[model samples]
Target: MDCHPRGRGRGRGGRGNRNEESRDVRLSKSLSYALRHGANKMGLQMNSDGFVFVEELLAHQQFRSFSLEDVERVVATNDKQRFKLCNHPEDGRLQIRANQGHSVKVTDLELRAVALDDPDYPREAVHGSYMKHWPSIRSQGISRMNRTHIHLAPGLPGEGGVISGMRQSCDLAVYIDVAKAMSDGIQFFWSENGVLLTPGDAAGMLAPCYFSQAQRLKPSPCEIELH
Candidate 1:
């Protein structure tokens, strides 16, 4: 249910204005799910560059409130495969598998938690692709930007995966009650994308930054709140 703002993959006229009917359907379903199964708690983490906030809906409080038993009944123990079409990154490894377009390359993977307090949250969602990297960004440019784009689960009973462009643009869905989050006193910020409103700022969103120590340029400014 990775609903987009209808501008996905339309950079410089890729598909700008060419809306897809199926995409619309998917967006609708995702919105419905987010709203229906509102989350209560959020997970936030900090880093050297910025804040990384994970809604923690998949395995945290959101799941607990929605029916922890259900989540426990379905999700895998490791929860590693929760995200779909993962790839083992390598240097200049673009076309490494059959599903290349869906396989994004990345180094120094990290996670964050975002609070989901208000009910209005998980509704005022931002739509776009995110495949953010530092070195790749420097060498490739905006055209080579990869971030979260599509969420594919097939609704096959117990499988969900957030997919994006190779090595970057790995899309994910975060349910947040913006109004309530501010009121409850919690925020996990990355770079000022100017997509948010209060304690925030834009819509020209950036990539899903990956902050790691093992990999150079593993994504700086990737921070999140501790509490």
Candidate 2:
């Protein structure tokens, strides 16, 4: 799905929240933290495909007070579509998993690569990041770092400005040469929200030269600037 991103952070476009909306935002972040980075500590075990039983997840002490309805509400309303719920292939039990951008280990999320020549492959892609990291990224290329894959957003080539769906922490947009990267053997995957993911190169990371251009963005005056 071409879902837009949502969060308590900036860049996510939303107005003042009602009590229910506030709770959903809070719950969504909590879910991301637990599933993508702290499943073990959250007392849940995800199978190789990065899936955990929804019932098991809700049973955790942190989530025990929340009902299945609450979980479903958050998933349904989440703008980013970060979490996905599906039926377990083996049984009929409901399961949940983070779509991509995982920092913690997940054995087999099954994110395979798409060819550069694929019709839907974006001509240009953008990576959101802080300006502080630009120098290193320019020299070494984008890395997944602790995450499972490098997260990217699709944009049109020759687009002169920042595209949508950037993270609040980002002040810079790095444009990627998707076709060139793929031709150079870098593989790309699509997340549930249409975010692009790549496994990088043989060294397990993207090289600096693959980044075609970058630009720093100014925040809107209405944005609540955070230090």
* Per-candidate alpha-carbon RMSD to the true structure: 21.1, 7.1
| Alpha carbon lDDT of each predicted model | 0.25, 0.71
lDDT of 2 at 11: 24
lDDT of 2 by residue, 11-114 (tens): 22233446656766777888888889899877789787788888998888877766677677676666566787777666768777888868876767766567
TM-score of 1: 0.17
- Per-residue alpha-carbon lDDT of model 1 for 121-158, expressed as tens digits? 33233222243433443333222223221221111112
Error of 2 at 171 (Å): 1.5
TM-score for each predicted model, relative to the true structure:
0.17, 0.79
Model 1 alpha-carbon miss at residue 40, Å: 14
